[model samples]
Target chain A: MSDSVVLSLAEADSLAREVLEAWGLAPDHAAAVAATMVAGERDGCTSHGLYRLLVATASVEKGVVNPAAVPEVSEPAPALVRVDGKGGFAQLPFSKGLPLLVEKAKAKGIAAMALNNSVHFAALWPEVEALAAEGLVALAFTPNHAWVAPAGGTKPVFGTNPLAFAWPRPGREPFVFDFATTVIARGDIELHRRAGKPVPEDWGYDAQGNPTTDAKSVLDGAMRTFGGHKGSALAAMIELIAGPLIGDMTSAQSIAVDAGRGGSPLGGELIIAIDPAGFLGDRVDEYLAHGETMFAAIEGQGARLPGTRRLAARRESLAKGLAIPAAFHAEILDLLQKGKDHVPNPPQGSRAGSNGAGDGSGGH
Target chain B: MSDSVVLSLAEADSLAREVLEAWGLAPDHAAAVAATMVAGERDGCTSHGLYRLLVATASVEKGVVNPAAVPEVSEPAPALVRVDGKGGFAQLPFSKGLPLLVEKAKAKGIAAMALNNSVHFAALWPEVEALAAEGLVALAFTPNHAWVAPAGGTKPVFGTNPLAFAWPRPGREPFVFDFATTVIARGDIELHRRAGKPVPEDWGYDAQGNPTTDAKSVLDGAMRTFGGHKGSALAAMIELIAGPLIGDMTSAQSIAVDAGRGGSPLGGELIIAIDPAGFLGDRVDEYLAHGETMFAAIEGQGARLPGTRRLAARRESLAKGLAIPAAFHAEILDLLQKGKDHVPNPPQGSRAGSNGAGDGSGGH
Candidate 1:
């Protein structure tokens, strides 16, 4: 632990936007990417924030991410929309297509958006939360390069596949959560390794298929699904639903096709939106009240609701500023300078211990 | 352990149906209930099989379950159907409405069935499996009486809500799984208590808000969700979606309203069906092939698919016989005799160690 640099939220967002702009991304695209990263940072999700920019920039330089790519959306069914990300960032497709998805759901009671050929690097909660804010129940699932082993398996056969869900509470803040099927996300393991901490025995295994507590060994081997078979089953479901169901790469396929681009895997995401009011009519209010009662009961019983802590952190960051490691801040400044010079090369060793590919921040 | 009696599946089904018929249930209604129970036994889910019959029959006798009730289906939206169960077994409504649901999904790419005022006692997998067998991707959720504590909470505030998912794999058994949000179902804990065995540390807590391994304390206090907060959040989502969203009772509400009827709680279920072929067109077979590849990889890695064991048990039971406790078999026979005598009273001490209001087998 060392002294950190405190940058106001606006300053962080502007700086991130400028860096992406310098890399030749369209202003709007840069803004979307910056907003996602800044939100992650504001919520204390450091792995999905500024920590990922260098790798993302490097990925752009390597042509793994098309800077000028535009998503193409099509309605295959009245309640189903498909967006081909065209090798661009996932945020672009989601941002451009979610409105239509929400509209369809509002009109049809339920709708689905399948996003394919996208590179997902940010946390998944933002997209789901966005949908929830529109007064809809939202669920999102995405697969990544295989890094987790299925239950009782020795090798990695699935991604730290992430699932996100959000429920709107009308006037109150929405309840949102995003979690990886793995017992612990890769970023958490990276942090533990950096801190020389031992992970739980069930978190992962060694190369030889034996359970290991060492974070470093687990990283080199494979992460284990949380809750054993239950979590693994969920991971598999995501792989099927978000991958092949959406005409994108499965985790195994992603691993086979992805080059060492030092960025997130190019894959797909499946998002579902359900309009509660459309289905429940006036009864929606009663549903919200029930949720409130449950929340109050949980709090009274000394438990915190999901997303409460993250929302608190976000509020605090908005009021004050984001805390960034001093060294990381210096590195960002260096990257800024390089960006000014039109140098697209990501600094070597900038992301030590990161699997040449991105850490799959969507799972974080 | 005592030796068990094995009865052919047909014999079990006929016996269950006869008992229900003698209790004044219509032949068709009795047949539906018997089929569900027999399927549970055939799949090795004894908790939901003959073990639940006494409570179910008692419910009919107490008027908690309307044996002659028929569900009314109304289409509120093109892709959404609301089914009023009219206070009866869930299977009846599902049996009547699933074809319509499947038809709607095929026409619109996705459809949802909101079933309210239903008593769901059988395992949820069967419903989702039926939909999957029709070449659809299906998800089912239901809430029960409050028995599980939210993460970090000291008291039970949510049900051991169960979620089931199924994916069709053409020409093969569908991939289907149903799991309770709690670490283990209440029946399992009751079994542990009866056997004088301790549960895992993470399984539950004592009334004093301290973690306890004693199954009896867990039974009296609260059952913790599996995977801590993640599972708890899922339970909460189910409560919102399946309860209030369907114009039914939330778990806490159900607990407050339900009398000691020695039966499964009267609640609601949410079923969603998606037509992959409708959305993906000719690409579905390719998707199925990808799933097979992933399954092969998982098997090669020494991992078993989630539903393999259940499917195997079902096949075996259909071929051989259903293994059941001799005492339970004799009890069912005795109940049949009582039914023949027009005795509406549930046998005294029929349920061992149940908390007077049944074990909420919705989670089983």
Candidate 2:
């Protein structure tokens, strides 16, 4: 974390969008990506924010992402649709596809849209959270680069595949529960590596299934499931439901194929949006009554609703303007400088084997 | 687990429904409850089957459930409806509510239904699996009775709330994933108590936050979360999304509330069903293509998907008939014999407590 001059939210987003455009993403696509990344930053999720820009840009330059590719929507029913990413940037699928599903859900009680052949998008909460803000409930699952192991084993058989869900509540923050079903997310591991720190031993295991605190050991080996077999079961179940059920790539097939980056083949995603009013009607009037009574009973006890922490965080962010490291601000400036220097040249050959662009800076 | 008799599926359903009727449930409601419970037996979920008859019957007889209650459906959209269970049996909500949701989903592509004020309805997988067999994908979640602790600290704070999702797979078994978000379910603890055995130390914590191998400790205290804080967070998240978000009660306010027994309130459930053909269309053709390739790769490495084991158990039950222990069989007969006894003219307040319940001889 650099301690330098702070960047306003607008300045940070401007730089990110410029860098994305330099990577050959269209204006609209670049803006969408920039918005999500900035939202993550503003919400204190620095790991998923601007820090991821360089690698995403590199993927685009390598022809792995089609700047102008259109998402092909295959609508099978009024409530169901499939968006073939068409080798396009992932931002398009999440931004364009999610709203479509939300629209259908608003009209028809519920809607589910699946995206196949897509790249890794940003965190899922923002998309679902936005829907919740619109008074709709949304749940989305994304299976990405593999890292999680199965229960009772140290095999890297699943991804940190995060599951996210959001529900709009009257007179309160929308309840959004977003988490990776792994002991730790890949970004957390990278953060440890960057800081030259060892992880807790139980967070991961080495080749012989021995727990290790060494960051290098976890990087070289496999990450444990969040709750042993339960988490692994969830990851596998998510893959079966989100991928196979939705006609996306399976984890095994995703691993077998090379996805240009030498990273785990990016798989697919499933998003379900629900219009609460469509189902609850006047019953929506009862939520505040029910929730208040329940929360009142446990007030000041060791119980808080799921979104309370996030809500508290958001409150603090709005009051104090999202506490960010000065070092990260400097890194953002450096990326802006690099984008200005590199122009729009397409990346040559496979830079995939390397752990992203070796700038030691983060932003996507 | 009645070993003295091997009732065919039809016979078992008939007898079970007959027993429910004797407890004052309407004929249709009794049949629905019996059908769900018998299906659990058929699917080898012995823990949730006929062994639970006494608890269900007690709830009805104690006036905790309304025998003549009818679920009310309120539709807010073409694809969504809310089913108010009216403090009735869980089967009432499913029997009358699910078909409506399914019908709308078939026409509109998706349906979201929230079932509120219903008692425990046994394991959720059977419900979703049945829907999957009808060529739909279903996701079901219900906040349950608190019996397990959150990840870190000791003391029970969350239920062994199960999340179950089933997807329709062409030319293969409908992949189903159902699991309780606890280290060990309460049923397993009762099993240990009945067998005069102990649980693994790691499975639970005493009231002082120390690990214990004694099953009684967990029953008197709390079972630890499976993977520390992350598991607790997951359970907490589930309670918020599956409970409060659906206009139901959270665990904090639901402690000591037994949905199966009388005088205790039930929690809420949210079920989302989707018509895959509406979403996948021609891509449904690729479901197996992609999933098989992935499963084949994992198979090459000896990895199996979650729920594959349950499928195997189901097949065996079909082939060999449902298995039941001789002792358990006798216990059921004994209960039936008690129902037949001429002690029907007991005092108004006459009811058996833990001590009068046959020493819990059939717990396991």
Candidate 3:
């Protein structure tokens, strides 16, 4: 009745690990990276789910990713931790540094982790949610390829930079939300292109600095930021905080480094963690309850919190398994077969430009 | 030609100090608050400038505020500074905590200051600009009265919820922005109401949950957030971080305590400072230069950065002095002549509701 082919969580996990491993990823790196794919699938984020397997095949071509490189972690100061991803995917470095970050946050009341020179490979929610699971508040940011323009300008200057925040709640699911500052994700433009539909006017501008609904021109031109100047300011903040502050690439620099390889974006990531207990001491629960009241007030009026839908989908996906498109499953399988040899050539006719296709396919 | 009266910066400062001192504020409190008022005037933020002195007089009426309470500062953790405002305005506590926060950030790489039970009196830009002036990156947030609604609902569950961020520049003025998450400000609606003008469609919703242009109806209903759902999420984050995270009141709780007394909102403020050297170390200059490249890209496109207009106004104001409205100046002079007794009544019909005229008048 449908194009969907459901995959159990175990099957999904194994499928991701196997494809990544066949491309010469080390067991440690493959497992950490595979978790992102399975988590995405389980959470109903089709953009970042097993669909990224095909995107990975295109990115993992020879000499691009250091599939075997090990991430290094160090605490350069009392409340700051540094992670050198060594040109590998960010997952391993994040996994390696998380415990130390949590520990330092508990010790100092506030802590930050600078993950530098890493290839971004997943959504930020998982990372921040992990901190919330440890009963800490968390914020994370990273610069992507230069796919968006600054406010009031037509040129592509800022990244579709993403910002994520998580807050811990007692005896319930932690509230989490991760979204791009861009009006729409680049993947959506590709979707419109494939479907032969025009995008919304607010989404992007044409090469002549005019608003355009034609998906192709928007892809060729520049995407606009959400909320206009306010969003532009946030994008700039993300670029500075996650880029230079962590000693990594800005969006423009990132694309220049990318240069038509269809690889994952290379840059830095910043994670800040705060321990409420440090400020509230024994009164933590009292204030957390106050947060619940605000939550109730929002829901009482039929308003949903940012991650409400994701959580609902998560529960459904957990119970009934993931429903991925059958065609995508075949593409992933085809990628699994051909990618075993790890061909260096870019995917045939799939990528549009240096910053094209899966450039935004993996992260939501 | 214009109905404006020029006031030298020194004269403006003295006028503010004398008015507040006459209202029974301690000399220290008066001086600290006077600086914010003058800075706003210098930077062309007329909302938070000397006009706030009028708002303050209304809020400071009766025994609601502690005219002479010294803030107490404590370091409960290595990276946390706590300031008990003791029913006083936030300015004094922020000033009291700034040095300790700077020391902690330098020593530990990151530090946070929590000011609890304080009354907000100015825009957040000055606090963050001060930190950037000290060579540290800073972020600040505080909840105003609950005058704004969440993304999809009509009831006002969230405050205007202003967020401010500042990054230190090597030699140039720091990149600073302080703004509410609302689409427009509550004060703008009042301005529209007085002029009998229809507000923009995106500004607010009426009591029936339909977008309305009637400023009075919108004010009676609720204002909308800046970027729809994304901005709503930010407002929620601000409420948690600045509210519950600091063991203070939520906007709803704050208003409940205020009881429509026409006073400044009562709550907590959270300020986080990050030492760039902690992350970049000796390579700090190299990375800061990387940030400059991004700034050049933005400016080269002829797109101005946030706070750009304010900085330009600051220079002109310094050279030419501030031009206050002649009528407003006369009113202040009259209040100054008769306010020596520190009357306790809330200022006439100039005040509106619990979250009335000046609720958003002092912060941009």
Candidate 4:
């Protein structure tokens, strides 16, 4: 307790919403972006939290994230949809697309969407969890720029491409698991950089193609694949699926195209949503219940679920007040409170969708 | 080379093909199975090579795998299909289904198939590699009977649930990667059992829910997840996608059903295939080239692509007569040369698809 601060979930969400709004994102997208960020924080994923606001806002300012653009279906099939994110925020397309997939999968059992040209918003848990809430299982994959080395090879050939999965449990925590295929995510490396700490030797190779413990080299070199070639292979596969198949720019090419332009740093995303009930029939309930019983058994001692620790942290914060390091808070207040004059926002009277909430698909 | 045994690839394929034919599998299927199995042996993956033949034959004899059944597409979409294996050997369905996916994806950019009721064969890499050769990237997920523990659960709740990915590279080995999400595949347990060895404590759980080193307990209880809960979450996700979605038997229920019937052991599988050239235009070559360059750095001195070693071994074996272990050769001969009442086959009249040939798909 001595080392913690708390904020009510409501307050944190409100602040997150306000921050996005201030950055000129449409109100609905703002809410999603905010909620996702807060959810990450609540779920204990600080790296993907509010700290990303500045970068996201900067991308929007650069015209890479079109807050007003709407995601459109580029191709349609029973089992898959190709979505053009239209330079909109990644969350918008994912939010809109997931529901559509759920709908179709309910009829057809399973459906997938290939998302192109969207920015990375935050951790993938929020979207998957949201889908799980609708009684559908969901999984998503996204590939960032080439930042990881293939096993035995050096040079950033692949991104920290990550995979996220969520399954509904009967009456327990919705099972959620998300992770980067790389040995270390770029954010983790950044954390190490900020702390002036050395990274694990196994995590990366230096620009010289030699294994090294230096964190800074990761910026210029490559993160090692997780578990050597196994991880490298997985990352490569993820890139293939989430990158080109989604019809998005991939690997070093995307970065080169965006060079100096400071475009939206969003990578490509591929998501699949499945309606378990379609195939499991009445057994869905029993299946999920069994999952919960088993999960609870595993939670026996002092361990926690993949995202539960974050939820617990979030609860504590909500019960108290959100903890913002004094410096970070001061920095936020300075930029947000005083920089309002410099920020550009959409003209005031544009209706924010029907419920005064923006639909998840459309941009600014 | 002291620890290595070199066998000519052609000789290996021929011998394996001979043994499989003796097992009552068609010649074509035998060729494909032999190819996959020997490929693993060639690539240094002894664990998945010749060792799998016995189990496969057992499954066939037990009437779990129909050597003659044809794999058929029950439902088809531009980007997806549902495959009914008709209790055929898993290799046949996978081999057939993979190419169908590749062809459809090439025509439409992406394709996926859910395979139901198939028996296990060899590793999933050969199929992935074939897809890569077809200039398509491939991902395959297979959920078997539960043998791995959930995070906190004492008993097993998932099978090893192997996942694999392969991407075509411009001037190097296709980026093939395959792994079991569990700390160990059940095959490893069987190996330990044969060797009368104890497994590492971290690999499995005891009946009371604590980690144990006894492989026997692991067999009796459950294998531990690869990285604990993270692995469990992944396994759960794979199960949802590969098992229930495929309209095949799933989890404990499926195993229980099999046990009750006293039949062949089998599970469902999900395969997702993407044609990179279908979407990347000229960018595909560049992306692959960049991947190679990146990996070239990591290749440092002696690093190899995930599947390259095996492919190399296959090449070498093809050049030289394959050398089979005296023990395995003896075993195969004993079965093939069984003393009496053996029906000699009219080679030319063998079932058309039964030879186990044609690019490892095992399509009947």
Candidate 5:
């Protein structure tokens, strides 16, 4: 009657693991991928949480994703590490490359990791937060399939293009913020359309470059970047730096290759990690302490740091477990019997592929 | 009859040089500093052009800037370069640090330069453009004196933090973008106030955290980030990385130190450079060529890249020369005769110094 089911953290984790493994993922990769899903749920990022399992299952069934692929890491340069995800999910490659990235960052003051050929479905905060946990400042970026347009353009030339950053906080959780450059997630638009509601005028433009509040029109057209041109510029930066700079596919290339498979965003992710001690030497503690004043000022004025909500959610969820929608939970169970039984909709208007513009992958 | 004059770029350069030399800057430092003002002029950025000369003269006369300080560089780590400006302008430190940064990037695949104890008065594009010219992708950030508030807060706790980036385009001008995290320059708002005009409602908030278009009240209060919370997060990132990571002052720290002599932003700048050869190796050309398609898509849709105007201005200025304001040019002349005769008002609000909220230093 409540239309929801409460499950323990362990149960949710097992559920995600089973879904991936059942869909043909190897045990090691399945575990690595499952951790991100569990973490997303624990942090109350429901959009990226357990719902992602359905998307992954769909991709695997459609043969758009390589479920058993092993991530391979190589030292492309002294301060650069390259991780070929072998056309698999990004989580495995990211985990494989973290050690080398952390090592190089510590040795050289800064270092970068380029994860290419991966299907990225996870939110980036977890990737950056992991590096921050190792006492390093981290910034990460990745491009989704092209769906958002440049500020003045009517057609899609850019992706949602998420940028994530984490700053180390010595005694507590790191400061973190990860966000899509688009005004809102494509999934949100789909939800709006499903609810038969109109969206904000600025959310997107139709094919004729006219502003529209119709969710359906936007889904069939292009999304706008947040913050106007500033956000648009940042989105472009993400596309290039994480795209061609890594010799991986751009969002355009990815979506073209996806061609309607409704798989996760397939491209490259660039992660830069810097060791503060490398720059500040023995004075790292002193300077970070000084940084506290700036932090205090933001909160003292009644504003919140971006990561505050996520951290709070993590704590509450860990203590009480995850409460997931009953229907979505049933779908996960159905996925065990038939991986294709529940497929999230594919993205719209970026050549919606065979799925015909269904909102698959939860969100970009 | 005309308020503005069309001066040859050389005239602007020479005028700037004479003012700096008269203010006690060494000839080498003066030449190095004058180049940025001239470049700003050439690129049609009048606010950062010859007008900055008066501000520099004020900083020197007030003893807040060390006009003759020589920048010193050191390599504390293999891929990290540090430049100590010794309280001089950032231009000198950036130049002194660039060679090593390029070398490290070429060797290590990526490198970073941290500039400390510098006065930053110019736009950031030049710094990144220089790196891009070296065939490297680049990113740069610096914190000015605190004048912006976090999106939901009513206090000035962050600088008009600027983020700059450049990507190489082989055989053509590199794609580039440099912008402040704030909605607009503090100087623009000052210009609005001086012109007795109301700014856009979202530009800033007044003392009770109410949205206000009154330029004076907003200036007396706090400016907003360009895109609400997203921009604020970026501003905070700029403060931490360019601030604590480099062992220099955060905007809050910088403003408190200023107590207000209306000097330039005294702080640190972080520059990261990456070599394409390092990532794509021999395939660099192939990938960069592939990147052209993305650019074509953007332009095909009638959208211009951020650097298109600057590139056009640079070519036009190089051919025809700079068009400077006659009033501002005459003010530079006045400064040479009496150091503080024509100081740009320091940045408004954020604790007006002994100068008493006079808009010295033009803007943050």
Candidate 6:
């Protein structure tokens, strides 16, 4: 196994933020990005955590992402919202607009927000889980760069196209789940490749359309949808709903438009929020009770809830510290040093490792 | 093979309506139920078609489904509506209230209708397809009696929770897809049992939680969710949203409440409609064009769209006829004959096979 190191959540967050700051990102943008990365690591999603910092830095350096862009949001109708990310990171617009979305849904029973011109590369759970924490039911869909093939099709025509859903359980953590339409996430395949391991046969197909167990072949070819045609239909649904419905590039369009940039695909995301209180009135508790019964039954049968592992990981990580690869830690530290050279004097209290132990609360 | 008879679309519709009428349903309810049954046959969904007539009749006979009850619709908010099924079949309320739902959604950008106290045994596509026909995007979810086990669990904790989505494709038939979260639908398992065929290993499990290919074992035990944990999460989501959110009996509650009824489970359904015109304005056409490009790309790779097979079956059934088993035909005829003894004076034109060669258009 490769050498690894454990960093406190505070240290990880501070280091990530300082690196982004050195890359010329605005304070708020850097903080938002850093928080998401830290949360990913906290939830045991190493692929979506600090590993993405390199790609994000490269994106900003190559002029593909505007580190200083301000997202603009407009209400087209009582229950309709449009947010233009202005070719910036998705977290910026989502952070700025999601509270407004929750308010609108509360006022109108339900609301839909379309986020366009954004680069989204984080785990989807945080956004929906945030809404659920606000006592609302939320569903979110986003299309990424094309990597999954349609069922029975050899060519990649759809993005991994992840979807997230969350339902509030009142005083408890929300019942949250996020998954890509593919049999497994691209990150899992990448991990397998990095570990020099073979994936399962159902994971993906070779370029010639024959099923293969080689993780490298899957990366070179395409991933297959889960459960045959059902997952394919779901991916297609997400592609249309999150893509063209928001007036952003579909998976195919994203490939065509971003071919020269070699950056992560920029597209739109669709989030629909429903205020249960508005519709169910005081009966929301009864609704939650029914959900409890389901959970109890599932537990009695020895089944874990969808987000159980993540929640467990989060608790452990918060209590201890995030175990990250030693080499990866060194790389981020190097980036931080170079970033300091570019920015010269860092902002007050913005230095890496300054926030010892962190608050270990909120922003998850 | 069992003996069978082929009946034209019109003849099939007329026969189904007359059978329901003879069974003491009001004319409108009979028509609505018959339309759905005929649609099921037209789309090659034999399990939901005439094959289900016996169960419908039994439910009505046992008073589990009130054949004479009237559905009530009330708008709780501008964007929210509630339909009380009054313990009747789902078709009555859905057929009566969905048009209003379309109008409300178009005027308000989005709308939701909670359908409670209804027995939704038919396929969900018809309801969402109706909305798509009116140039709207629609999502529908319904929970049934507990049949599917959650991932890693030995007991059934969820229904074969079905979800349907439809998108308007403008000049062509709407793009519609409906599927249960289970690896296979209960009806397909029944068909396998009837045909004395063994299912695939992933289809279901025995009562002891061991994987099995025996259809009888699955029926006696539980169905497995498709796509492993992801599908389980989806089923759980549908159970919560369609069950508790609508204040109806959840899968477990339905099983408890209906234990003595020996009839189809009754629950709630949640339908959400979105009007592209209200949100996207004239760009609706552009949105559809993008969908077309996706379809073209998928087809280029030798992949068929989700609803392709169903649409083809519908066209063929409309042009030629629906071939149904002779034993099932006789059983329906016998039920109709027995029903005639209960209701002496049938309405004018309420006779089996009377509406021959009816106009082969619309509805679907």
lDDT (Cα atoms) of all candidates against the true structure: 0.80, 0.66, 0.83, 0.66, 0.83, 0.81
Deviation in angstroms for A151 in model 5?
Answer: 0.8
Q: TM-score (chain A) of candidate 2?
A: 0.84
Residue B72 of model 4, lDDT score: 71
Model 5, which residues run further than 4 Å from truth?
A1-3, A340-364, B1-6, B339-364
Higher-lDDT candidate of 1 and 3: 3
Across A141-172, the per-residue lDDT of candidate 5 in tens digits comes to 99988889898897888889999999988799
Error of 3 at A18 (Å): 1.1
Of candidates 5 and 2, the better by DockQ: 5
User: Could you give candidate 4's per-residue lDDT for residues A74-127 as a string of tens digits?
Assistant: 444445666566656777767777756676656655566777666675777787
For the predicted complex of model 6, DockQ is 0.38
Give the per-residue lDDT digits (tens) of candidate 6, residues A237-335.
999888776666687777665655667767788899888876577667866787888889998888999899999999999898988878888999898
User: What is the per-residue lDDT of model 4 for residues B1-364, given as tens digits with 9 covering 90 to 100?
Assistant: 4433445677677877777777677776787678788777777677778766766665555555666667776443345666566666677777777656776667655566777666665678877788888877778888776667776676766777788888777755677778888777777887898788999988888777777788888887888776555566677767666765444544554455455433334657777776665545555665455455445544654566666666776677556645667777677667656412244332221122332111111211
DockQ of 1: 0.47
Residue B265, candidate 1: C-alpha displacement in angstroms: 1.2
At residue A222, candidate 6 shows an lDDT of 90
Q: Which pairs of residues collide in candidate 1?
A: none
lDDT string for model 5 (B1-364, tens) is 2887777878778878888887777787788889998998898787887778877776766666676667778887889998887777778878888889999999999999988877888899989999999999999999988889997898899999999999999799899999999999999999999999999998898877788999988987899998888999999999999988878778877776677666677778999999988778887887787678889999998898888888899999989777666777677677777643444333332222321111212222
Task: Please give the distance, in angstroms, between residue B50's alpha carbon in candidate 5 and its true position after superposition.
Answer: 0.7
| TM-scores, one per candidate | 0.91, 0.84, 0.93, 0.78, 0.92, 0.91
Q: What range of 10 consecutive residues in model 5 chain B has the weakest lDDT sum? A: B351-360
- Residue A316 lDDT (model 1): 90
Residue B344 of model 5, lDDT score: 34
Error of 4 at B278 (Å): 5.7
- For each candidate, what's the DockQ? 0.47, 0.35, 0.53, 0.21, 0.52, 0.38
lDDT tens readout by residue for model 6, B269-309: 98999887765676778667878888898998888988898
Candidate ordering by TM-score (highest first): 3, 5, 1, 6, 2, 4
